[model samples]
Target: MAFPRSTCLLLLLASFLLTPLEGHTFNVMDYGAIGNGRTDDSEAFMKAWSDVCKASASPTFLVPGDRRFLINPVVFEGRCRSKKIKFKVDGTITAPSEPSKWKCINKQCHSWISFKHVDGLVISGSGTIDGNAEKWWKQGRVTGARPNALVVARSNNVQLHDLSFKDNPHMHVVFHHCDGVKISHISIDAPEDSPNTDGIHLKETASVIIEHCTIGTGDDCISLVDGSTHIDMRHIKCGPGHGISIGSLGKFGLSETVEYIHVKDAQFTGTTNGVRIKTWQGGRGHARNMIFEKIRSSDSEYPIIIDQFYCDHTECHDKPNAVEIRNISYIDVKGTSKKETAVKIACSDTVPCRDIFIQNINLIYDQSGKQASAYCKNVINGYYHGVVRPNISCLQNDKLP
Candidate 1:
């Protein structure tokens, strides 16, 4: 068969164009990352991340299995050339033991592993991130600041799954100022006495989903702070910590808003508090449209609590202003409370909690001799249905002037 030279050249070009481009896989070891658990692998990780960030094709930065790589504080930054990136970690990544060795370049540098300003990022693995944080915990009380184990900040469409975190000095995993984030199949563990080790903390984030996670730590299993909205959490197992809280908001006289949050299908055991919303006294803003449903608790203190005057100090100064909490509902929550008061709604006098609804609550004191109770103050438009302990009549028949 004879063909013109021009026709043949065109055909060749077409074939080349139709071929699929090969994607790059940047291995950490190839970039001089030693997984011996002793050597610092921070530079190697950064080098591999830099390479992948600039790759034209969607690339993967891989940490191989069965090795422990000691990493210092590092940031994986974005505005990357690649539209999608996979951060695969099948091995362990550990922090340094000495707290003084941690470099304090900025507030973001306090995290051991941080992903910032990245879009379409996927962090998935069956591995662990161990913050050797006993020493840091002891030092943090004096220093008044401690590092987080993992943080995803200013990223969109990020997914984190199948990872384990342990012994964080402060918050274990944080999603800060991110949108469209999904976290699932994760496990977080720390000692019950480990100070301020929240399992997962979300702040200034929106459209987030957290599901199928098991978390036990010193602080809240999941904490949604101010500027967080449209969050959904389900199928979570929380214990030995403060169970799933919203706020401590409106702190330092700041105006904070949290809304459209939903939590369901959670179990709490031996927790200090379950499903709580707390706000400082002298602050403004509002928390609204929140729902907690199908929560089961065992020997938990304050299974449901809304403390508008949330002060930890013993000699706290009295303040008039408060965060307006409204349109909150708790449904199908059955539990055994260690404390005599199973439900406490202590709203502020100036800005009362309103439209609070409770249905099908069956909380009882752990001690069979003691009766379950509910305390309410400065709460309005509250509704109750089916088996409310201590009775809603107390609120309905109040004659206070």
Candidate 2:
């Protein structure tokens, strides 16, 4: 049974080549993370993420279940060795309950947890992300000072689903300056009186898809601001919030453009507004080629509206310039309105809305036993198709520049 030394070496090499390497799991607990809710596990999380990013094969950064990890503000850096990196949060990740424990630079921390430059990232699990923002909300200051829960910026091909985000100080999840994003089966919630708690906010992002989400918050369930295009949303349930909005854009006299947006099969209940598009004066650019279809609203105020004169402040100086809105269509919108004006299209007098189409709309004011009506101002070249209730009498087909 004597074999040559070269033959034995060759056999060993073949065995090594055929064997598969198992994927790594970098658990935060293994990196000195205290699973207790009070301990600061920020450094342990960063350490775990560092190893996960440096791993050559598919690796998972796991926050296992049955424990609460208190982590402060941290950013997970990207450009990882493996593109298919998984951030599996099976346990709860909580923010510092008090402002004193929060780490801020110059008294400002914009986001609690941020993911930057991470491409092909997948964040999924049945765990909760608790902002622990009760003290912050009690301050009752309405400024851009509060920190959002989770933010993913400058990334591509990101997927987030099966997560629960609750009681965030401000917006729950924000995707900024990203492309090819998918969010589904996620739950976001906060108290109705919580200020600026938007469910999902997108800015400077494109090629996004949001579906099968249940969101109830103080602000818009989903808001798409400047430079967002090619967005598709469907099967969403929004309530106790400002209904899905597309704007507050062109603020600060900035030029912004949003186009090719589609929202379908959304259900809104007890929301402030159903489908809204608002813009500020003294700004340039246009919002065009948008479609809102198959929306059902119940006891909502302003089921369909387009306010180019959207001024949130008390003293907003009126300017001559305005954001142009064109080629917007609303189809099959059936709703029960809480207010008398079910559909309000208050466009700018200078730059009127063009090619605005409303079709198959049936909205009624069943709350106060009054009639629901339509209000339109500075709107031109509008078209009304099949069964538009409350009859938009102000629509003028005359082309005026």
Candidate 3:
């Protein structure tokens, strides 16, 4: 019974005061030259993100190097319980092509990087957040007003890395109702005839992990905004734009139920199609167990699509009765099309698209550059066999047949 060296130094000082270190790295150009590039320096980078995101730390917040800063939507106020704000951008944070210099103070602006009720946030860097956005997409082509780039609400354990975004007036990135999120080695772009440039927009998110990204857009290079679920998309390099979708949900009847997803080794170019899922027409719920592997396509259209009566805008005056797609699968999806006609599936009239699967795929379409046809109302089952468009016969609406 040999105790007492001052009671073992008071139990080693109570385990070093309840062990918790590593969280704090701040350096906005060493707090000077204030990130030049026409600086407001966003109140000295929100006072170094409220001083090391509530110090007690050693990791996160080092937007280093050749700076060119300007930001808005900057309400990164602290008290995140822990995990601390970690933004390690090594240069280039440009985002003020005058959205009225990010006006706020009750105009309710937020997002050039945002987070609500934060969690262990860690935005990585190979540096570049440039939303120069070609004069706000030329004023959204006469003031349509597009907007969205790096927004994470109702936060969770979020992590972004090796960044690079270009010309984004809208939907370059957004994850609302966030859960465990992780996006990697990014490279995004716009101008596939830029309209509503989308590339990674997962609203009402759950568990997500989008990897090795590269998207170019006008729309839907990842638009599943409506109560998402555990998603895992890999090696994606989607298109000139639009593909990899699962929605276009109707109004606010929002009951979205997308299932466990796994899209692998992807690649699509000039894409208007290739693994798509659209829903509207009095939308209720249900998008089941999904899986698309080894996907590859070019000059796409019907590269693999599913439309549950998705009517882009206006024209879906509520028409769902038998809606509910199930266990979907596409394997060995290979590319090289664009003379047109590869694969397209459309459904409704009582929700036609049902349990489907495509195997050992190889699609190459082009009978006259741009092929896609399908208008199957209440689509049932299919083992789909390819090749159409050589003196076309039935390639259906949105048109070619």
Top-lDDT candidate index: 2
> Tens-digit lDDT track for model 2 on 1-401?
98999999999999877653337788999999998999999999999988888876778999999999999888999888887889999999998888777976566878889999999899999899999888889886754488999999999999999999999998999999999999999999899999999999999999999999999999999999999999999999999899999998889999998899999999999999999999999988999999999999999998998999899889988898999999999999987998889999998889889999887889989566566899998877788777788788866333323
lDDT values for all models: 0.88, 0.91, 0.71
lDDT of 1: 0.88
Which number leads on TM-score?
Answer: 2
Per-residue lDDT tens digits for candidate 1, residues 1-401, read 89999999999999878654437789999999999999999999999998888876678999999999998889898988877888999999998888877655574346778899999999999889999899987765787678888999999999999999999889999999999999999999999989999999999999999999999999999999989999999999999999999998988899999999999999999999989999998889999999999999889998999998788778767798889999999889987999998888888888988988887788889858466888888778877776566565424422323
What TM-score fits each model? Answer: 0.92, 0.93, 0.34
Which ten residues in a row are the worst by lDDT in model 3? 391-400
Comparing 2 and 3 on lDDT, the stronger one? 2
Which stretches of candidate 2 lie above 4 Å from their native place?
A: 1-22, 105-107, 142-144, 368-370, 396-401
Candidates sorted on TM-score, descending = 2, 1, 3
Give Cα distance to truth, residue 7, candidate 2, Å. Answer: 7.1
